[model samples]
Target: MLHTLPHAEADFRALVRKVTMPKPTTTRRLTTEAGAPIADNQNSATAGVGGPLLLQDQHLLEKLARFNRERIPERVVHARGSGAYGYFEVTDDVTGFTRADFLSAVGRRTDLFIRFSTVADNLGGPDAARDPRGFAVKFYTEEGNYDLVGNNTPVFFIKDPLKFPDFIHSQKRDPFTGKQEPDNVWDFWAHSPEATHQITWLMGDRGIPASYRHMNGYGSHTYQWTNAAGEAFFVKYHFKTNQGIRCLDAAQGAELSGKDPNSHQTDLLQSIERGVYPSWTLYVQIMPAAEAADYRFNPFDLTKVWPHADHPLQRVGRLVLDRNPDNVFAEVEQSAFSPNNFVPGIGPSPDKMLQGRLFAYADAHRYRLGVNHTQLPVNAPKATVADNYGRDGLMASNAYDRHAKNYEPNSYSGPAQSDQPLSAPLALTGHTGTHAAPAHAKDDDFFQAGELYRLMSEDEKNRLVANIAGGLAQVSRDDVVEKNLAHFHAADPEYGKRVEAAVHELRED
Candidate 1:
């Protein structure tokens, strides 16, 4: 038996007291950038308390300098946005179509960040604006980060990327008026016959989504997927909202825009906070590579969608957004996504819009957020290390392997590239020249637009006609309005007639 020491209880009580004591107030002191304690944040050093600020005060100078540069440039497009953290889980076996490790097996889950944005809007623009919603997702997988940059619509305004800047400029505020001019918008549409399909969709009932959760997302561009066997297929992605499609009518959207500008962002945040997670079921329409040549439409056209009947959507996976970002600025605003960020098995198609985006997006991010943007927590790969020769840049926080060589092709064992290519090489036999897309049997600008208009219900047709008329009536130029009306008429005689009548009535009013 051990004998208790004299004053043992006293010593034990002292130890407990030390363990339970509150931390020192000094530990909570405010600090400067270099981590030195700041003596006073409320007061600045001055010449004599009543004089001009002292330049010798390092903290005062640093604070104002940092505050001056607190903001980075916003995105040129898709500026107004919200984001969330989630996971994409493969619910079916899709290994035959693509050897992408993220979708390698059933029940495989990949962490992801999704940003929902409104195209052609400023940061301060209303969320309820009738615009194409951007649905870009960045998946952090073991292979690396994969970004699927897309829009809500299955089609777009123009087929060629060369027209993108002009299309956007027309949609943007006019230089003279500082407002979106109907003449500018309508003139562009009248000239771009390919835009008729997307314009019809845009001015229709679903122009404004009720909330971010209720809208469907589409990988509008066709992509190429190569399997483990090296066989390739063209694919398009669709994310059907489990919450179901819901849209705000023109009146409702207008009211919401005035009353609550942050309605969409707030709705998403609160829904996730209350444990009501939003989910989307992922589907892919796959076409064998050889069939693209003889397809009814130019399969790579960004302004046309493949008819679902020809290639039915196959169930692939589910994406559930379960977490709200703790810090929106750090996680959402600074987040960078690029379509060029492809893992193994997946590659860009011959779609001109997609080919342009492969360069434009990454270049934009590098310009907006420094070259080290990928090293940011939200964008950095979670399951794998980025072992490349990329070196020092702004905000490069990763620990450098100083001993290892920075350049490749070295005996010192620098990071080397994989010997295998990401995807199979495309067959090329054409002379390099400016050319239009190869014509397919049923390829025409107005056919699909007509098909879409004809598929709408009678009520939807009424709304579409009225919406188109409202904007067209504002255009000062009669030629622009008539040219646009002619394209709608080409789609369908009834569609053209209805829009013309509606525009006349609106003009009279």
Candidate 2:
């Protein structure tokens, strides 16, 4: 009784109503990657199809080799993803705010590649899982590759990097049983109450977004922006979807997940092919560096958000993803991004989470891919790159030093690091000490979760309560379920009452 039935029946019906799968068309023209007509694809160019296989056959070798290398190690997170190529167009004049070349001119267009992904799942996991979806974008700007590493939710589960690996482990397979553990999940979540804000969003309708297209994206970190006048401002990015925000109830997600694991992927690719391009309006909330001290909330906290009413969204640009990737493995899987690739105007803030990702992402790529991973076309900058060092590693096809000096600080006319004129040097004052996060007066982890619940429609409310009870009922300990309800109750008394009622009713059944 603790378990609720999967919503396959309801979700499939929705898919049927919204979009129909295109019928496959047969074709006679078969060709290889190199465009040679494949006359005998069913049978490789073996000695005779029955005799000893011939290594002399280059076509056969090519085909097998390509097949062998089809897969790369799936990312530890953000495993399931879909990609598209597009152009990001600046819609307003914000050159006074940041001198980043892509945003310097109102009409400037930068070629962009975006990947939408689900976190905490394997490559083949269902897209409808209750999880965070990554909204990472790679802007191939004239200066360099600019990566906006973001997620659907504006806030994250944790503010500290120390707890990240442990939190991920709880979401992953348990070591002892190699299956998800109810105890493991709650143990981590319960101990760190800061996760409440994000957990609420996850358990609500937003947890399972309708698809990548329906959900909005957020950079979700406080970043620093430098103007041409040598002044710095704290900035946060929000990508508001023009198509309108949408979501699936837990029942709808569970049902759709089992019926079609790749529903989100299909929804995106089909949307573009039909010329119904999904777009997001880019906005930034700018807080002058001088005013950071008096902000009500810890301006740098990843767990909190700046109220839009207080700091109005300033229109900067628009992003339209119009073309799907031609090859999934080559383009989508190999796409790498990192926060450290900032240009002249854009820089990092003191946000701990952003600080961690700035290093962790590039390092992850180095280990997962290689030092030469940037040479891959998907990750390469669109503008010409001039450099002296950073040469020669695995699959190093981008060419090596043509200069006499391979190291920096030499008198040779080799490329030297450029100094940023826009940035006034920051002064450091805090003592080197282990410190707890700055506390806000009304800041409890549960307030936002409660607010999200209060905004749900009557039916959405029922679905949310039911979903929580469904997952909670599976816990063997009644105390664990009670503790979770206590959290909901703290957020909103009615929310806790509803979830508690659902759990009790399910338990008796």
Candidate 3:
């Protein structure tokens, strides 16, 4: 400390140099699309100094053109999302219930990609918005890709898909004002009485989830699972978060949205990065196929839930998300999922909404991501090769054999049908027409919702009423407000009375 000798002085000088000097970097030659090395990259080609830019500047032109076409069309719903790579490990032997290869053995694992999204948001919307979260998982199994497209809530607003577009339109911004209108929202809900159960859920304490990791995911539609013996059972999937349920109130959600719009995305990414991976325990409620005919309420109704008392959940597997996407745009944004993407044993049910989605989801992907979207790495099957006769389209990378026959039933053995249907076919008797749902013993729309309201604690009920009134009071039409109140009244008398009083007080103020 007093004085430095010759060696000490040299050591100090070396340390200073090490701290101040730039780290050594390797030379990697930049190239054009054709792999030619670029001589000049700092400036664009010109006729002369400050004269005119040359059109032959391939690099400049290519950059501009690519930049111009950078963005693709956003999704109509669930546009704002975050995705992760994971593995779903079968924890229990479900071979007895389903012949699906992925769930065949207790220790079998299937690679998967999951995307969590806000239901009614744009690309730039805040992650903390009070909206239902889309919890879609694509499992790349040995047989094929099986997509479990679901949502955080166990039930939805409407049972029929015919009303889907109108319901979404009401929830979205008004055409004229470009703002979400309470009048339109409440009006639609008032008219759609079947929406009562889901409305109760949406206005309840769990509406605004604290984070994607803390919420449960449900296959809202009933699906069919066939055993190896060809016995079919109706099934509903539930993925309960291991992290536990956590939610935000109106004040907290608004505050988080303002402070960090991408809070959910950031949280997921950072959690994975820190090696604090999030996981969910998968459970299923199985119903005997024969029981659907007289299950108190329609088992296939998307707007209803199977009571845990009737069909207790059976433990199945666990999904652990351990890796974040390397490139969000290529892996997450461009990813596609479809309810129709089923393997050998798992298949669709007679659920009206589910039946509509089996066609609609795949068609939407074709329109948005092109017919060859399945060839993309994120959507592609990992354990099995796709050997179909599907040919070229935009950006087709020729993932198939070049000399193979293009059509089936040919002299040459192209890909042929498996001969086995995915599930046992239902015996159809009723005529195909625009008809109401088949009646059940307890088909009335309001009783389960009433039960749900009655199950809430005092504080939860208070918050639910306040939250509902905050929106209902802004509705311009008295008839719309009254009709919505009546639906609430049908659910629970005390629930409806409190909400009605709150709305009136707000309107008066």
Give the top-scoring candidate (lDDT): 1
lDDT, candidate 3, 97-121, per-residue tens: 8899899888888999999999887
Q: Write down the TM-score of every candidate.
A: 0.94, 0.86, 0.94
lDDT, candidate 3, at 462:
92
What Cα-based lDDT does every candidate model obtain?
0.92, 0.83, 0.91
Best-to-worst ranking by lDDT: 1, 3, 2
Clash pairs, candidate 3, are none
| Model 1 C-alpha lDDT per residue in residues 196-219, reported as the tens digit of each score | 999999999889999999999999
Q: Any residue pairs clashing in model 1, and if so which?
A: none
What lDDT score is found at residue 274 in candidate 2?
Answer: 100
lDDT of 2 at 166: 89
The regions of model 1 sitting more than 4 angstroms off are 1-26
